[model samples]
Target chain A: MLRELADILQAEELCNTQGDNVQIDIACACDLMSDVLLHAKAQCLLLTGLTTTQSVYTAEVADIKVICFVRGKRPQRDVVELATNKNIILLATHLPMFESCGKLYRNGIKGCSEV
Target chain B: MSEDTTAQVLTAGRVQELVYELKIEDAMVRDVQTVNVESTMDDVRAILREQKISGTPVLCRGELVGIVSIEDLLKALAGGETKTLVREKMSPNVVTLYADEPLVHALNQFARYRYGRFPIIDRKTKKLVGILTKGDIVRCLLRRLEMNHQARERAHYRPGHLFEDVVSDKSTLVLRHRVEGSNFQRAGEASSRLKKNLLSLGLSPDTVRRIAIASYEAEMNIVIFTQGGELVATIEPNQVTIRASDKGPGIPDVELAMQPGYSTAPDWVRELGFGAGMGLPNIKKNTNEMSLDSKVGEGTNLRFTVYTTNPT
Candidate 1:
């Protein structure tokens, strides 16, 4: 499921390969850390356009372990380092937010709010 | 030792740790009742009666001289010396505690001296600061034990079960974290700590998430906009309250700042993914009650509360 999810997003691995085999059935797509905090469920994969260290912190607090930066946004070295330290998986894709969510949805990854 | 005896020893060890960790100032009563050394024994009796306390400290020219107990007053009355000065009847060899000393010292003093109360004094100035009784020590220990119990109950109990046996009239857990302004690396450290504490208290996942989000947003605002600030989360039985305050440049237009997409953040902040103008709006959306007050040149204060039950 993890490899399939990454393949669907056409994401490049940035850090923490240990979660590559973990199952991730839910994905939350958002750019704002605030929205992610408010709506993100635990263990969900976060797809965002923002590539800041705060993004990693938001995921850490929300219990999200994997993040795929959409819109081809590669986070700075510090951001990647923080995610690695927190054991969070990081990925990057050239697709925008809507397309990334669409591709993942088509591949059987459910949205966080879906039943 | 048997399993049961080991468990008893562990509990006793924890209590010992608490006494050493807690300071005398934490258990002492600050508003102490006192009597002037020149005051007559009759004056001490009236104070003990009005304050419903058994003893009062005697002071001379704003300096602690002795302690006058009800027994001292009774002796004065029986000997027909009710009009005698407290300086003559009160015990002059007073035993006092330093405010900064550990509570364990106070406990040892109580056991060794068999005294009813100890007047707490400033270590450097020798000025009386507070009064500590056995009752005060007990109350302080009980309150701390309750907090630790809730944290430990998470392992064996379901969410919300810790509150069922809470007998205290009011119990609150306060968590405070300092946020450094513009420190992107440590922006959400405060909120993360708050979330961890809330989870350990056996709160529902949904409630923890809401508080975490609201606090995270508030923390980000401080890092992005101001010099720095502090985030304090107070968890109560019915609600969780968060206060974020800073001494940075305050908002000039609160009404406009509340808008979903309004922001004054520099382009550099935007590039880091924050300052999306969604910070305040996101906080408002997640919290049940919210308020923000700011003085342009002074500071800003933001307070929000989230209810634990029947959230709408």
Candidate 2:
């Protein structure tokens, strides 16, 4: 599913590893780290616009394995290093957050609560 | 809509609501450690070391009074004040954090104060419910990244598209090479043939590189370990799939052999430094997906795929 999402959004891998087999139980598209912390699952695909070391830290704390930056917002090198150290996959996509979430929802992806 | 208007809407649509809605309670630690105000500096130092913490809030009869840190302890000890009470050394002007406040507010405090941790006070009870640290905030935020990679397992369905027709298709060419055992000098013959084929087809540099690595590794494995094998490379519109099957003493342990540096090659093969046992592992690493099926005596069938235009 992540591969499909990447293809749809024209996403590029900012990090080296690919979680091709990693199961993403839920999909959340939000820039607010607090909301994600409140409602995220252990195996999730994060789609957000915020590109910062704090964003990467927040995702790792929430146990999010894959993070997709929307609207072509790639994380800085330091953020990439932090995510890499934590074994989190980072991708950047041209699609905005709403459209990315909408496509995933249309393709049977759901929020963590629904799953 | 105008391009500028579209951009403005995207930036403006959900700014304020998201900014004010997130609070410190969502990510703060609830169980806070505190030091009593009357405790001696030595006692405070011991607690910090035992807990492996940098600091803690100082409490006096259930009322939050001040905050103390390891730095404070060091400063006191440096001044030869081991007998001084924590009340004398702790920072009395405690910049407390409210759980109900916006997380950004907490972030601002962290930036402004340069403190390692803050004592979080519950809004209604007005008492310390938890400790908020920079590490804690990082952890909480990382935990919230929503990653649901529920990709449907569609195996290599890339038929050429209209626009991509001009660029090229991987399906146009199919090449096969015969590798004979003991042909040490000609071991890389098949791999070079496939490389020439891929390069001639005008494929992407990344795709060509991946195919080259997998094919070369596969070829080396066939020549070094097997009686002989046939190497085949099939190009499809979207990806390249390579299959190499040998007719020799089959690998009894596919998993173990797939590990790097697990070569069962004879002393001669090792002396050649050609079989460092990385062939199979290299093939697996270069390809996006790999499947290996083998029996004790029959043979081994190895297959891998590399996407052409885009990385899978």
Candidate 3:
């Protein structure tokens, strides 16, 4: 069952982040944008804390649906604006990286098939 | 009217309240080392040498403070005398990451910032934990590619599957010879032929694009660089992959070969409007994935892949 992106973002406490309603199936959590670029996984949500235009570029290149910024650190205004323009979801939470990932995992968001 | 109002309200809500949960941390590296800002330059150099390290975090009173590197030491040495002081030369305001952050976050941070390494810290205690380097990220990426290749092989998808539509079962090993260094005016023969064959097979537009880009880049590299080489085009149902292995003098610096704005092509190649140094970059840009293996004085082999889903 597809859940509402806004619901997930709020539950994760990442609500002022960009991705709100975009659908994500699997999760591809990595700090390295290059791996995301080379890895082919569909409908995957990107979990990261990177705040840069390159993160947006990587999302565009890899076709990621959502970005979850961990550690409560928000993206720069330009980054959020870019996501808005691209229709890519951006979300952030205060949870540390491991806990954030675990929260999603417990909720049934698995990594991509190859992970 | 009520439904339209509801739609507008929902849309506005969507804009303000999007959330995301964390996923798996893709890459992890241990044994990252650090130095203290108060340490002497001698100590810094010794630490770097002992660890075989290029960059090190400088800590003060167990708090992340600055970074010191070979560049700093070299700069100090080049400017005047080698100052034994570490605090005087260390780079302040270090960019950092949390220990549990995802690799994608680190990748962006490194790429955008051009940082060689990041000090990983505990969020609450903010204690310095580990360091994530470019090497670690690249390692993760290479591992991912290898895993993907293994999976494809298990699925009976050899690299050659990219050209199955054009080559056919009876014509797999044949290499069509184009003129050696034949320029772009004569560039698209191999590509056009392959494209025609794919078009006849009713390949999707995305597939045709992959084949076209792969073949075009490979063909151009052959014509522009080598004394002469054959153009090989291969196709498969899901992927279009190209291998352009040439006997050109090869790349002196393989890393620079991949970098944009660095090219060894002749003036004539540029005059013909070809060598803008965009050949390899374009190949990399067009393909969904790529890899290069080259040895100086030996040869260069460029491997390019474009999926049917992503196009050429």
Candidate 4:
């Protein structure tokens, strides 16, 4: 995906203090921290409602590149600032939780299917 | 009478009202016994043993001044100084919270600060009235699970069904499922099962983390939004891939959908404590790469990838 397109999909831009030079290919959405720790795919975007520092930590541990916050929820200052320092693309949207995932679905993003 | 419609009607007991009643008060401990600071070492030990308490708040004339735990007493005794005053060995910092605040907030505080116990104080009077223990939170989780089970039973929803394993690897596993929209309760069951499988397969902790986060997020979306859906996961040597595709209402705006604190889940879902608008963001944060594709009316497909590198 084009860098600009990825940024647009996430509806976010790099902060002045950081670089937005990166890429992504898949996405997952969830609120349960335990489930995310267990099932996230590689080289993917994570969508979630959790805004704690641990959420970002989980992302780093999982090696996710982009983070999209669904339902207009904003992360705490520490979370946003932390993502900035970590070079993670953090974006926000006003779409409801499921609709947001649906929006991505309707666009042609294929999942990492076992078949 | 149609059984499907009848079932829907019967199972329509609102989850919102139920969870509203579950608001944090029941999870809080309302009364706590405290000890005087002037109490001798022997007296403090006796109180702890008698009360089966690990720690006690030390008060000076009705004001909390310090805290003396059993560990402190043991250390003092080991040093051959049981006659020392409780005030001398007590820890001064006392973490506290109000009785009426939400239990979730208290739990967050506990996780953030690593506090094993917290004093519940009156916000207006500044008087210690209760104690909040880790045990209290565990009890609350048990209650929540029990209530969820009761709600599921009321809905006549089966716990696990409609999934078949299609692939597996040293680092990943895949499953296929043909899902119907109305059976939302069973949606994340596949992801949950895969997580259990990963544990059984002895996937590294890093690899398991990637797989679990991606799968759960996709599974939850399928359950909540799809009228009917298919789920597929690919486990590669270094990463895991999960996809959920649905033929249902599609998203018109990808930008708005990725925002945090946003949700369209009914009050019922909110009450069930399921939808907090963190699903996608949590998945994104946990994975190394992600992509989203959707359209209005045609259908939706969501995918996730989680990568693992050998930990140092």
Question: Candidate 3 versus the native: TM-score?
Answer: 0.32
Task: Kindly report, for each predicted structure in the order presented, the TM-score of its chain A compared with the true chain A.
Answer: 0.95, 0.90, 0.79, 0.79
For residues B129-150, what per-residue lDDT tens digits would candidate 3 score against the true structure? Answer: 6777756654555566577678
**lDDT tens digits, residues A1-115, model 1?**
6778778989888997475578898999987676676667888999988887888889987889899998887888988998887788998999999999898888888888884
> For model 3, what share of native contacts is present?
0.00
Candidate 4 residue runs with Cα over 4 Å from true position: A1-115, B1-174, B309-312
The per-model lDDT (C-alpha) reads: 0.86, 0.73, 0.62, 0.65
Instruction: Report DockQ per prediction, comma-separated.
Output: 0.36, 0.02, 0.02, 0.06
For A6-98, candidate 2 gives per-residue lDDT tens digits of 676678988846567666657888775434544566568888887765456545544578989998777668778877876888989888888
The best-first sequence of candidates by lDDT reads 1, 2, 4, 3
How many residue pairs clash per model? 0, 27, 30, 88
lDDT of 1 at A11: 89
Candidate 4 lDDT over B16-105, as tens digits, reads 233234434566666666888888888888988998888878899999887788889999999987888888888888777776776656
lDDT of 2 at B76: 99
Candidate 3 per-residue lDDT over residues A1-115, each given as its tens digit: 2245335544353223433345566787766444454443645877776656546555643456577777776867766776676566677767767876677777777778645
DockQ, candidate 3, comes to 0.02
Residue A72 error, candidate 3, Å: 1.0
